[model samples]
Target: MEFTDHPTGKRLAALSLAALGVVFGDIGTSPLYALRECFHGEYGIAVTPENVLGVLSLIFWSLMLIVSFKYLTMVLRADHDGEGGVLALTTLVKPRKENMTRGAWFLVILGLFAACLLYGDGMITPAISVLSAVEGLGHITPLFKPYILHITLAILISLFLLQRHGTAKVGTLFGPVILIWMASLALIGLHQVVRTPSVLAAVLPWHGLHFLIANKLHGFVVLGAVFLVATGAEAIYADLGHFGRRPIRLTWFLVALPALLLNYFGQGAHLLSTPQDAFHPFYAIVPRWAIIPMVILATMATIVASQAVITGAFSLTSQAVQLGYLPRLRVTHTSASHKGQIYVAPVNWLLMVCTVGLVLGFRTSSRLAAAYGVAVTASMLVTATLFYIVMRKRWEWKLPVAAGLTALFFTVDFSFFAANMTKITHGAWFPLVIALLVLVVMLTWERGGEILAERARGLTKPLDEFLKGIADDPPKRVPGQAVFLTRSHNTVPVAMIQNLRHNKVLHSEVYFLNIRTEQIPRVPNFEKIELERFGSGIHRIIAHFGYMEEPTVALIFTLCRDKGVNVDMNTASFFLGREKLTIGTPPAMARWRSSLYLFLSRNGMDPAAFFDIPSEQVIEVGARLQI
Candidate 1:
């Protein structure tokens, strides 16, 4: 039943192969444009040996320190039950002392913003990655130039359309092909390196510093393009649960890191000898007869890369919804064995539209490159800030130790961020604007939900005490069981209270069901149900779920029987309370914000359907309130 059953070495090797297809796919394809961009992009500096060696040195060190150390060595170790991401990191942070400081709130907001920016990354990465890959066709024939846009569109559109079908199959098959891709990158770059031995000298740190000194501001600008090499580094940690630290670290250190540095230096060496090759150095390095074949391979690699990001976006959105930051969304499980493979309709279609729009608007990879690095550097910096908090507060590291590591991360992160900042007017504003809008929506919903909870709390009555009153009165008891869904355990459900008040009768047995999503990804099956009994046939049932899990009423019923609470689904009635919000009195939020919250509430998904309650067995009680 396990995914991997081989010996540790073989199993790790298989997982590492799969990791290349998913974790490193995005960064893997960077070779197609990263080095080329340094010398050919709009901000590209002169192709002198110093600049070439400097850029190569920067690219190499960036991968080791940023991707290897900061992420694999540091951030990957901070997983929340083996989950990693900006939102996941937020859960790890504890208050530095007590009363939430403005600083604590700032870290929280920064984490949210960092998470939001990734949607933009999701859209832009596919466009730029695919565009850059297909653009390689230009190297073969000028005839392909006019048709490049059309070709890119066709590939991207096809890729997005396939999301509904899921990528489990493609992911399975992509492992070897990606190995071929990496091997091809190394082989081709090695061919160039052998011809030009002088390029290896750039491996030293002095060349990078000397180049930066000679070029000054221009060198800083080139750092923005160099950043493309490590943009997919975040995937290393994001996918820690899938492959584990050993496989991912092994892949990075053994396969990916070496191939990337050699290829980059090879490109630098080639460019030093043949400066005219800057146009499309990645494809240019290939033999003339192999150019078309290499382009084909590169395009396929880009598709797999795009698949990883698209899949990541879906997973993140699901987590956000489960954690209560967003409204209920329709989530479809694509694989019976793999709960992680999910498809979201709204998110899928929205990303498609935005991704296609980016392709059409940006027109070329060179132009899209300007918009790419901004969000990446910003999110990385935010992660550093959060990671520092975890070290100091959670891990109990000394402030100086935490500060030293944070400073190292920040230096690299900020240098890239400052370099990319110059891109805002050109195109970097895109992700920032998207992140800001999403931040507003998230914050508004959070505050609005808090206000609603406050009002609901005021109306809550102690369940045991309320049941005692009913016991004294002895309201007429009916047959069959009533399951009332409540938001909290300590309070009586509004539906149960209303049913008693208006209907003047209670079911023979009443069950108060409260569902709570836990911070971890999944609750153990044995620990899913917790029950407490009270007088007058009143029972409280608490169901627990992980963020990655779906909680269904049917599952609850099935599991409850094993825990000594038996019920027949055919005869049971499910009760729900719908609150209609009206903006009046001391409004819970600003006028516009209140309206936004109301709009969201009215359109919010039906809890019955979301919980998989039988439609025929459901009864609703409605009440109006001013928030």
Candidate 2:
């Protein structure tokens, strides 16, 4: 169901609560480490009263300007058919190749790279978030310090292993757990703020301005740590389709923003009085009697955060596959009611191994924090760049207004990005490497599909010519029906031609079906199919689906029936082409990329399985292709 379908007050409230678990988990949990990092991390400064106020001012204004203004107010409005994300935003500006100008192509690449960066961010978020929560055990007692790494690996492994069981059952508890978590943040933080009301002075911009001037380069370097506060701001936009703009905006204003501000200021207040607690400010705010319970709650909150990121990766992979940027992977739907709750095994396991490796390698959240902000800041920069294009081109805003807002966003994004760049040698290079590798794969798959389509067009005859030739020959007509799946709408399918050549007989009814993934999020049922008759019981049916949808044979047939065309499932056969790709002498792509593309092609999910066709009635026609 679309978020717009439910506009009732009760339903909106319910959705906003659910959004808290899924949308705000990452950002909510930032209080666990953000304040601590600014004073005790790799580039941390002294935790005097002035420094406390300065860092708090930076955190407060960052959240207000970047998360509040840029994302919730501006970026959230740029949804593509109710879907907000880099991919959705990319399609809005550059929907089709025919419409793509040089500038559009550059934006598209930036968007794809932004998507790749998320994968890297996805890996680090789980490791660092969970590790930070688990490290609270160290505060409980020094004894747990020796076993923090082992404990973190266990939780991460269990989390990934549990993905196969689906989150339908566990998801019910997410809302309540996170609600309590946010409340705790506010309560504990408010307690400290009451004790040290002087911390409120940081609300003014001058303290942060003075901090930067006094510290100079060191203060600028601290932005890498300050950027952590809003690292999950993108999640607010990414999950826009799930909860809609109204609920997300409402939740942020009423619940998330207030609670976050309270907690951050509370931490600042606590630091002003007890500077030595900078190493563990978040936990220090908790009462001694409540430390164990708080740790448990924090761990749950982090798991919820990690779950959101993992699910996002799966959704992103699905979108990439449908949009033809990646080869098809096995997608298992875990919920009948929610099409978005899907699990991709390859993605799940790969993430687990990498996350566990990160925990093992870094061994502490402080170290992992060094590797975190680089990719996220880069992604935010891309989002800001695309948002600028969206403003000028899609929204058609006046040049001065669009440029002014975008320039402000770019100033913030680039500053954070530049600050994080200094961390490359300190392990920030890991996500960059991962993003580059994934970008190569995506670009290779995209380019390879174009080359293959060009070659296929060269090999196949036009549909009209094929039909005319068949009419003249008058091939023997057989009983029942045949369905041939093809990529091109104008050209004849290789499988249909092969069947006609070998079997020497035509079916009574023939369907040349082509499935197209459109740039939107979801296409309505009435607008899905275009049917045309080619005489002699031959027809061409082009099925249109959106990037967020899965096209199935049964659904297509049902739509066809509505259009006055019927085929008995028991008597129908589905024909598919299985292409064997080989490197041509000249090579259509770089040698390594061609090899990578070939490997991906060979291992991709079978067409029959991908389209939900019955395996017993499927026939594969093999063909060889060079390039």
- The best candidate by TM-score is 2
lDDT per residue (tens digit) for residues 66-182 in model 1? 998999899988877766778888867735335668877888889889989888888999999999989988888999999999999999889888888877776686777788888
lDDT of each: 0.85, 0.91
lDDT of candidate 1 at residue 81, scale 0 to 100: 74
Model 2, position 115, has a per-residue lDDT of 89
Instruction: Report clash pairs, candidate 1.
Output: 588-627
Question: Compared with the true structure, what per-residue lDDT tens digits does model 2 show for residues 180-256?
Answer: 99999999999999998989999999999998889999999999999999999998999999999888998899999
TM-score of 1: 0.96
TM-score of each: 0.96, 0.99
Give candidate 1 regions above 4 Å deviation: 1-7, 94-101
